[model samples]
Structures are given as C-alpha cells and as structure tokens.
Target: MANIPVIAIVDDDEAVRTSLASLVRSIGYEASTYESGIDFLNRQSEDPSCMIVDVQMPVMTGDELQARLVEAGRRFPIIFMTAFPTDAVRQRVLAAGAHCCLSKPTGGDEIIRCLEEAMAGHAAQ
Candidate 1:
C-alpha cells in the first residue's frame, strides 16, 4: 500500500465510479476513478494502495485485470465488486489471489473495511 493510500475505483458504470470515489475520499484516502479496466490499465501512472474493481465490464473483467497486474509484477490489494455475484465467481477470484470480493450496492463502510483488511495483509470475507 502507498503511504498516502490511494484507492482506485474501476467500473464501467459512471454512477458507481463517482460514488465510490467520493465515498473513499470522504474517509481520508485518495480516490481515483476509472470507467473501465482498460482505462485504468492505460491511464494510471502511480500505483494505488488498493483497488475496487467491478467484476463484470465491457472489455476486461476484474479478475483479468488482476492477472495482468500479476504478470507485470505490479501487485496491489484488490477488492472485486460485482452486481451479479456467485459462489463460483467468489471462489475463482479468491483462488486467483484477490484481496476481497464484494457485492454491488455496497456501502462506504464495507468498502473501508475491505480496504483496511487488505492493507493489513488479510483477505476480507
């Protein structure tokens, strides 16, 4: 995690991206928003402390993004969020070494909790 603790929120939905960014900022962390996985992959210059990425997106999914990061040797604690969550999805992401998996319509506190857990080197359930 970065000393300043930036939390990157990546999702295809404009509303979701905005809301999570705002909520994360309110809690005293630098929040960056991206509308897609490719956007974050191409645009992010500085590494964030944690990532809140949507599971389902147009071009690339959160799991795929994680895989890319791993291959590139850039590891950030990742929290995967999904509107349509399933046990298989959850298990797969966890197996792939994601920090946490969250359901959409999630509250700010839950996100904070996940972030906290991740930063502490613990995978949140």
Candidate 2:
C-alpha cells in the first residue's frame, strides 16, 4: 500500500493546531501537530510532505525553523501563517523559498488551495 503524505502543523496555539489538523485530514492527508518548532524537530519521526507553520511562534519562529531546515538540507515545502502579516515578513519567507505566507483567520478553502499548490510544486521537483 502507498504511504499517505503527511502535513505537519506547527503552532503555539492549540486551537489553531487542532483546527488545521482536522482540515488537513478532511482533505485526505495525514496530519501531525506540534506546539512549537522545537517540539517538531525533536519529535518528528518522518519528514512531512509539507509544513504549515506560524510565523510568530514563541521559542523558534517560523523563519528560524525554515533556516534550520534549509541548513540541514531539508527543503520541505513550507506554508507560513502569521497573525501579524507584513510585507517584509512575507517577502522574506518567499525569498527564502517558502511556498507562501498566509495571514491568520485564513479560510479553509485558501489553505486547501495553497496546500494543493505547494504539493504540486514539490511533486514536480
């Protein structure tokens, strides 16, 4: 049997993690939730197909996590969500090769679309 693709959701907010996990599962992907970037790094048993990360996480911010992953040569597609969206932050992540950076309260449909796009791009790589 084929292995299902996993999508990791990393956020300090429990509610955000739960809701995003449900959405990811609903759209036919396995979902993993982590309360922080450090938690994810220490606990992830397998590399996820993609990551949905919050930019302003407490311990390890999304940018820091992205940097660490890149330094380790793990280029899993990343879709960042930030409560405080700014052009600078978005551009920085984009320049660092993030799939996209989304604003909080983002709709389920938009998240799905971004997920599909990110997965498609990763598949083509």
Candidate 3:
C-alpha cells in the first residue's frame, strides 16, 4: 500500500519465478515467489498487494487459486499468465475480477501497468 508495492508471484517453473522476481525487484517493488499456489496460501501473509500467477502450475492453476481466494474473501488483484493463452481462459480469469490475463512473454512495462491499475483500484477503496 505504500510506494514499494509487494507482489506475490506464484508459478511452478523455477526459472520463470526467478526471472519474474528479479524483474519485479528491478522495478523497485517487493516480490515474493512461490513454487505453488498451495505454498503461497500456506504462508498467508496479510500483505495488501497484487499477485502474478501462472495458469499452468502443477498443483493449483491460476484460475483455481483465484477461485479459492474468492472463497476465502480475499480480493487482491491478479494478473494471470500462461504460455498457452486462449480466449476462454482469458475470459474466465477476467470474469473472476482479474486485472488482466497476459501471455507468458509479457514485458516489464505491461506488468507494471497492470500493477499500477491494480493499485489504483485498491486505492479507490
């Protein structure tokens, strides 16, 4: 909620998570990486921030995680990413109130933009 936004990045791919964390940190935000959605849920940090999750994780998919978050009454904005992007998947994530559903090759600028948008929505509340 301050100047340095905290972003939770959940993905099964170690390389993807590492790269994302590095990129996110380079942009001056705090990034926490989790190997799986269940891992993140276990930590349960009450940090008010946004999330970047992979759609094809091993245990729980990004969409499934979003549903669980909703069931638990958690409203942090999410940006779902997938290598195999599809209209149906995008629509599903969007309908779950995600800020965006982006392809895996999304750049830092796009991620930053989504983060800013998500922060703005939180600010409004």
Candidate 4:
C-alpha cells in the first residue's frame, strides 16, 4: 500500500490542535499534533508531508520553526495560521519559503486548498 501522508500540526492552543487534527483525519491524511514547535522538533521521527503551524505559539513561533527547519536543510512545506495576522509577518514567512500564512478561524475549505497546493508543490520538488 502507498504510505499515507502525515500532516503535522503545531499550535499552543489545545482546542486548535484538536480541531485541526480532526479536520486532517477527516480529509484522509494522518494527523500529528504538537503543543509547541519545541515539542515538534524533539519528537518528530519523520518528515511530515506538510505542516500546519500557529504563529504565536509560546515556546517557539511558527516562523522560528521554519527557520530551524531551513537551517537544518529540511524542506517540509509549512502553512502558518495566526489570530493576529500582520502584513509584516505574512511577508516574512512567505519570503522565507512558507507555503502561506492564514488567519485564525480560517475555514476548513481554505485549509484544504492550501494543503493541496503545498502537497502538490512538494511533490513537484
């Protein structure tokens, strides 16, 4: 059987993590949740097909995680979500190669679209 793609979700908010995980699973991808970027870095055993991350996480923000991954030569596609979306932050992450930065309470359809784009881009690379 082909390996099912895994989606990693990193958020400080437990409720957000739970909901995203359920959504990912409902869409037929495996979901793994991490409370913070540090938790994800410490526990991740394999590269996820894509990452859905929160920008304002306490221990390590989503942008920081992306930097670390880049510094380590990891190329996982990342999608960032934040309650306080800013032009500066969005531009920064996009410049740093993040797939996209989204606002919190984003619709499931938008997330699914971004995931599809990210996965397609990753596969092409």
Instruction: Report the number of the highest-TM-score candidate.
Output: 4
lDDT of each: 0.87, 0.93, 0.89, 0.94
Q: Candidate 4 lDDT, tens digit per residue, 1-125? A: 24899999999999999999999999999999999989999999689999999999776889999999999999989999999999999999999999999998899999999999999999998
Choose 3 or 4, whichever is better by lDDT.
4
**Error of model 2, residue 119, in angstroms:** 0.6
Cα lDDT tens digits, model 1, 1-125, are: 45678888999999888888888888888998898888998999677878999999988988898888888888778899999999999999999889889898787788889888898783232
Tens-place lDDT per residue, model 3, 7-98, is: 89999999999999998889788999899989999996575488999999786898999999999999888989999999999999999899
Candidate 3 — which residues are off by over 4 angstroms? 1-3
Model 4 poorest ten-residue lDDT run: 1-10
Estimated TM-score per prediction? 0.90, 0.96, 0.93, 0.97
* Candidate achieving higher TM-score, 3 or 4: 4
Q: How displaced is residue 48 in candidate 2, in Å?
A: 0.4
As for model 3, its CA RMSD to the true structure in angstroms is: 1.7
* lDDT value for model 1: 0.87
